[model samples]
Target: MYIEPSYIFLVVPAILLTMYAQSKVNTTFNKYLRVASISGYTGAEAARAILHSAGIYDVQVEMIPGQLTDHYDPRSKTLRLSSTVYNSHSIAAIGVAAHEVGHAIQHNKGYMFLTIRNTIVPVVNIGSQMAMPLIVLGLIFSSFLVNLGILLFSGIVLFQLITLPVEFNASRRAISILENEGFLAANEIGPAKKVLSAAALTYVASAAVAIANLLHLITVFGGRRDD
Candidate 1:
């Protein structure tokens, strides 16, 4: 029931690191958006071309209202882009659109990691929301509950681990597609890669922080139960 100073100290650095990583990603993405122009096609047009070239006719590219909210929905078979990406002619926009299309390509080609990530999506979603509460409750109540919390929290961590590959692979696919399909010039490649790489790091930071916090939690609570 008592808060551990050690755990607090450990989490403080993780919180700061994650925030800094997120800020860098946003700053880099915006910087590239301003400097690197998309040669001709808009992000939506480029995404469609990429999808059509891959013989993916069923996927739809639609504009949504937001900043950097682009994503591919496997369930709906839709590639959703924020207004900036959907309308802008910028390297960052194309890069992000291509990244989402990369997910569609993965789905079509049956990428193993992507498939596994999709399969665990619902379980991870529910587990993430419930894990901390269950762990705290278990700490206050019973050893059995605490162990159950550990198992559940472990699932969340596993999901974060699985997500790393899925995200990295998508960025790799985006870069490859941009190069092969002539969406970006040689100079544009640098900025595009930087944007995608920055975005990917945010995921890495999230996973790292999650695992660290979970370990801190277990170290404190589990040690208390032993005594």
Candidate 2:
């Protein structure tokens, strides 16, 4: 297998930015870790409350192990939060939990971007896993496989790009609900915003990294002129 120094140049900046985004999330979360909501609701309770307010009773709130493993599963109709978020009453925990609930709400409402993302998931997974091996084999054997591999990588990048808007909209909904419903008090909004915004930056950084990797691959291998 061939590696390109250009790959480092392309991917390093995105890696650095992703690290920065992760740091920001840790800082913001730690800053608000002790700060509880005025309503004194744990993150799991907050999710339930927000879902009820949104008239979404069908979604189940459940706990799983690990840190920041929170996510909403559309198929299972379940919202799973990390142990920290599931039981903690901290602003950071509540913010994260609410964000996942926003995803549940999106699924319930047939959110367009989410619908698109979900529809493409199986293909994207297959494409992403297939890209590198196909590219490597194409380099060694069949030129026809090269362009196909690049296209597969591009699909992954497209999926990441679509993910950005979905995540931003979820954060928007979470913040709006927290603020409007008084789960976040006037003075506490900044920390919650910082936490969610920091988390959003991580997604942005992930998309950026995917794009950077795709560009680097294209630059190195995309110039083949014959099959």
Candidate 3:
């Protein structure tokens, strides 16, 4: 019963949620990407302005390649923005840039959740990389290894759960900063909110996927303990 087909059944909900989240994010971003902010600032300028306004000077903003591939590297204290976001003056671009900067700001502020998430990065990385192999080998060889693999994989689930708040808070901070600083007009905030909200749902969907995977392991492997 602990086969790929069984696992598929278990993860179907998460897979569906992930698909919906992706579609929503794409639709929202495309809809808002055409609308320019009244301030006429590019995404890089908006990110720089937000960082300066927050009294955060250490985090450097750099243009990175690819679409919607923006992220903040806390270890390097750098904010990497995709070309579309770094150069475009679209409201969606600014909103996304601002959201990434919010992560830099979080780093500066020593946000507790962010701190915890960063602390576990190494473990999660290793776990994600090794979990499948270890789990398969355990299934073929020893029950102990199966439990070990399952335990390691749970780190990924925990990481995803912690990430939900980190992402949501960053988006919230981004909009608040944009609105309060007059970077986004009153009417402009709606589209920005929609984009951020859609993006946040992706994180939720990711967590769901992780949880589903974890549950499938427990359902399948947990039975091995009795045998």
Error of 1 at 5 (Å): 4.1
In candidate 2, list every pair of residues with a backbone clash.
Answer: none
lDDT of each: 0.86, 0.91, 0.92
Model 2 over residues 16-98: C-alpha lDDT tens digits? 99999999887888778778778788999999999999999999999999887899999999999999899999999999989
Provide the global lDDT of candidate 2 against the true structure.
0.91
Q: Each model's TM-score, in the order given?
A: 0.93, 0.95, 0.95
Error of 1 at 65 (Å): 1.7
Q: What TM-score should be assigned to candidate 3?
A: 0.95
lDDT of 3: 0.92
State the displacement of the C-alpha of residue 103, model 3, in Å, after optimal TM-score superposition: 0.5
Candidate 1: pairs in clash = none
Whichever of 2 and 3 has more lDDT, that candidate is 3
Error of 3 at 65 (Å): 1.2
